[model samples]
Target: MSQQVGVVTFPGSNGDHDAWNAFANDLGVPTRMVDYRETDLDGIAVVVVPGGFSYGDYLRCGAIARFAPVMNAVREFAQRGGPVLGICNGFQVLTEAHLLPGALLRNESLRFHCDWIHVKVENRSFWTSDVEVGDILRLPIAHGDGSYFADDETIARLESNGQVIFRYCDANGAVLDNANPNGSRRAIAGIANEGRNVVGLMPHPERATDPLVGGADGRRIVTAALSALQVAV
Candidate 1:
């Protein structure tokens, strides 16, 4: 059976449609756009919190969105071992929801960055099972607040637990020192929960699924989630 992925859209979400299209057409899967107000979590194989300025970035990147009914449902869904993927602002929401650790602070440059970035696979999280450690993928990142920050102990624990899923790399997939685009600690571009069911990243993999659109490495992520569903079944 085709896996059904849910693409969540908030009041100001701009990537909902794009995510749905990429997951559905490019990946040859089925997808749904879940409203932020809904609270039901039935029959969804995977949930994607697409990138956008939810609630105008009020209070914080995802503070307001965290209180949304859909997020509450999403939280419960994640706790049940459901696969949840968050991108850009969605990453902020996951952190705020406490599904994932760390916070996404404003870029060190304090600028709205938008461009293709190189990210290294640091661990074999569920969202990156198809990705090998040290492999590099090109994906676009468009956000102003994406610097990941956690206490020293938490950082050490995350690294030790193999939860750090991605790190920023250079053109040749070489890990750079302090070359982080957003001052993210340890160059973390993405991470996963200890359960490996919830994933959050600052890059837009959905936007990178098509080489015709600039890159195809993005498809690996969506495909990974699809693989998760099969594992569950």
Candidate 2:
């Protein structure tokens, strides 16, 4: 049976349809578009918080949406080992909800950056099952408040726990200090929860799932996720 992935749609969510099509059509999986206001969490194996200006990106990208009724259910679902993926502004939401560690702030340049970026898989987290360590891929990134921040101890803790799942790199695959784009420490681009069931990243992988447009590297991620559904934890 195909894995069922739920894509949450907030008031200003812009990537819901794209995420849905990627999982359902491109990846051949069952997917549903869910409203953020809904409370039920039944039958959801995987959840995706797609990118956009949820709640108008006011008072922080995800501060407002964190109180959505569905998030409480989603939090419980995550605690039960359900897979969750957050992208772009969704990444901010995960942090705001404390699902993932660290917080996203304004870019170092204090500007919104939208373009293709190079990312390297740094750890074998749930979202990176098909991505081997050191593997690099290009994906689109569109966000303003994406500078990842955390205390010194927190950064050390994440590193020691193998939670840092992805990092930004140059075209040569070398870590570019301060090219950290979003002022993220250690050039971190993505990360997974300690249990590895939840992941959040700034880049949009769904947008790169087709060769017709640019690349199909993202299919690997969706396919890997389906495989995770079959394996009993």
Candidate 3:
């Protein structure tokens, strides 16, 4: 009996199916699409909030979607120590929900950036237990408001508590300003809650699950999460 994954799909979300395929087909895991209007999360061991322009990206990247009914359930799930993974726009939503710290601001470049990028693992969390710190992962990012911003106090807390889970880096594992595509503070690419059960990132791991598209580094994340949970994959 494998733990089932729930991928939430809000209106205007475009990456729900992609995430579903990654888990259900590529990772050989069971998945259910939790609807936006539904406030149920029974039997979902893990919740995935995939990337997309939710609610037409109005007001802010995730401000509107944060009020969705499904997110309320996801928030409850996270509070109960359930694992949650948010990618791209999903990351924005997590921030809006306050499940993860820091806010995603408009890119300094003031333009949408869509490209394959490298992010170094900064700390291990529930979803990244199989990966070690300093490990560089290749993935894709697409967003206009992906820059991460946090108050000094919050930044200090995240740094001291090891909540910063991912940082942009080069191939040789060097964190450099040039490698930061979104101009996020300290090149932060991802983060985890204090409990480490909830994680949020701006890159699209769901897009890199197959080598046919590019590389398979994304599959490593899926494998790591399932393995960490003692779920057979």
* Candidate 3 error regions (>4 Å): 228-233
* Residue 63, model 2, lDDT: 93
Q: Tell me model 3's lDDT, rounded to 2 decimals.
A: 0.89
TM-scores of all predicted structures: 0.96, 0.95, 0.96
In candidate 3 the C-alpha lDDT for residue 132 amounts to 80
TM-score of 2: 0.95
Q: Give the runs in model 1 whose Cα sits over 4 Å from its true position.
A: 1-3, 231-233
Residue-by-residue lDDT tens digits, candidate 1, 51-105: 9999999999999999999988998889988889999999999999899999999
Q: Candidate 2, overall lDDT?
A: 0.86
Q: All candidates' lDDT scores? A: 0.89, 0.86, 0.89
In model 1, what are the clashing residue pairs, if there are any? none
**Model 1, TM vs. native:** 0.96
